[model samples]
Target: MPTSQAIQVDNLSKRYGKDVQALAQVSFEVGRGELFGLIGPDGAGKTTLIRILATLLLADEGQATVNGWEVRKNYRKIRSHIGYMPGRFSLYQDLSVEENLRFFATIFGSTIEENYELIRDIYVQLEPFRERKAGKLSGGMKQKLALCCALIHKPVVLLLDEPTTGVDPVSRQEFWEMLQRLKEKDIAILVSTPYMDEASLCDRVALIQKGRLLSIDQPGKIVSAFDKPLLAIRTNDMYRLIHDLRAFEPGHSAFPFGEYVHLSLRQPIWPEAIHAYLAGKEHTGIEIKPAQATIEDAFMELMTREVM
Candidate 1:
């Protein structure tokens, strides 16, 4: 057929009881050979959407398909062609690394020898611990082992839910590099994470918050679409900077970012104006500079509008 199958969702919705809406008519499509990221904070329905795609959870409304097979109609077929790695390390703790891989391969009616190349790169890193108990492995090793198990079946689509949530920085970087290599294999990869910085690594990202999608586009496009003047304000007293900036622009947006207070200006004003205003408040070491908008910044801007 095509290079690989696509994951499609249309007006997907999920709710818990009558109170919490886990997903609100979410819709998106992930093309083959593309790495699509669902970027959101905890409780933003990222996991729920990922679970639905993996056929582990059912949605209350709307339709979803993996590899053109509807989630409800042909779930077994879909499962056979897709690989899922949940946020947690779900491998058999008692099983050795090699045993775990073999177990998963046998369950899928395959063998490591049959699809060795698919996972060679990742598995090579874990080979030294082939006989080691999965639970005894380090976090990074555990992550690699789990990934090997997921890819042993040679799946056409890979679903990763918060794959790097608790991983160390270097391990996280390594894991992402593996994903990039896998993407080159024409596998449609859909990964969800709460880390905004990781959004830039994806081919496209969907910004979700509170079970609703805020924006969907390339990371660069999302940042560029924010056509507002962003400024970082720092002073000798960082705590008072936020209050002073808010007082200066009541209708504008001002929030703490790193060592400075980031302010989103609704109208253009020279940097000198802010210097004069903050100086009037008797603040020292005043530093005001234009800041670039990131995916996180764009998400915050959209969420702020949604609340107001």
Candidate 2:
């Protein structure tokens, strides 16, 4: 039989006030031991949804269940089986790394040694500086420590909200590696991130924006769904190229993507036309290259398709 869902949310909604709808009837299911992601930019209600699932906040409407326990009614039991690492570092600043880990383990009615294996690989990195105050640790070290404490109780479900944000590139890669190892232990994971590159690492992801669910599918499938031809054009006169490309076609959309401007041509446009336009403007060595659609490209299209 198919593994039962580790988490199920249906028609879930949350609002902070009359003006801000944090979540709008969002719905999805995370399978047991699956590494699911809520991918979106800032103020997209990711944190709001995570808080509600962690039992730190309540939804205004709809229903959710974590490991078969209703969120509204079985929060007590649910809390015991989950590990939550919020977007921000919320550990005791004054306490040492070891102290923070010990405190959290105690709060869950367990000890560090009892669940050492659960967080062993993560904790070892923090072991060298175990006596350092949490506030004094670097961004990467603090993140590792926070994760260790969250996992001290050997939770079945791990909820990490932007766990790699604000860390160095090396640290970010390491953090993802640790998460991959955790997946082998069959711990269900739900992580939220604004980084499009990280979406592919998830088994499945939901693209969200403005408190609404946009798309839900595997990363490759999401990229495959982007049915638009894109071209990357770059020239010595970067500013002029962007302007010319926009006016090249009546309905074309062009914007800078790193060193080049990625354009969605309204119809078939010749590379010579692109080169000629730039050449006429005294632009030099203009290069036009075919491009592939990425998650970010798909996200932009999904967000603006309704408006346009």
Candidate 3:
């Protein structure tokens, strides 16, 4: 109920049918004007959690509040105070860009003129194709239109479920820039995404997987938490590199990162030991060097541990 925490979810849980646990005792909060990210892979309960906050779905247990209103009990009120953009395009395909915006505004009992300033930054990019049907627009244009529709109502909270998914690199950059601008308006924003690169853009992020949270903190802190000495390894026989590393007694972790495989050891060991081990296996062109930890590295570490 405090003004500071605009969104609060306490011990929330959800299930699909008898076996699938979508969320389990999940809990977190979003402060006013904070840009919070729910970072995870697909089927990680990110979408389920977003829907509950948007009042589109009910949780099987626990509580969630938006703008000091309980999500399940005050869904009608919560719906009006929150702007939601689903992962997929849910707008009217046949409607023109301007028409779709007007329709959403009408549903919320608001006129475009009333909150024109709120979406002006995002809508201008779509204005050139205002008369174009929503279906005819490119992926980026469609996203801009969706964002315009979501913001036109001037809601106190914004719930965006993977807003950058499938968008081009340039559009993704532009969209994140728009979000940065919107954060200045003091609206609590909760966005979900599987992209680890985007986690750094948020004020704070919750790394989640398999309906459970691995860690929640600023992106830098998450990376800093990885205290192990990391090394990037690659060899001519890259295919067998992982298996060899996994078989090593000192190997604590090994995950592929683009051209290099990041490996962490359980105890302090010299690089010579790793080199000697690989050389004895007849692997040629072996390359190994110190590496930095990233959000992806941290997530993979946690996810791998959860399974082990």
Q: For candidate 2, lDDT tens digit of each residue in 1-308?
A: 11278888989999988999999999999987889989999999999999999988999999988888889999999999999999989999999999999999999999999999989998888899989999999999999999998899989899999998888889988998898899899999999999888998899999999999999999999999987778898988899888887877533678789999888776767777777877887888789888898898888889888566
User: What stretches of model 2 exceed 4 Å from their correct place?
Assistant: 1-3
Cα RMSD for candidates in order: 1.8, 1.7, 1.4
Residue-level error in angstroms, candidate 3, position 299? 0.7
Top candidate, metric lDDT: 3
Model 1's number of clashes is: 0
Name the regions of candidate 1 deviating beyond 4 angstroms: 1-5
The estimated TM-scores of all candidates read: 0.96, 0.95, 0.96
**Number of colliding residue pairs in each model:** 0, 0, 0
Q: Between candidates 2 and 3, which one is better according to lDDT?
A: 3
Question: What would you estimate as the lDDT of candidate 3?
Answer: 0.92
Q: What's model 1's lDDT at 171?
A: 96
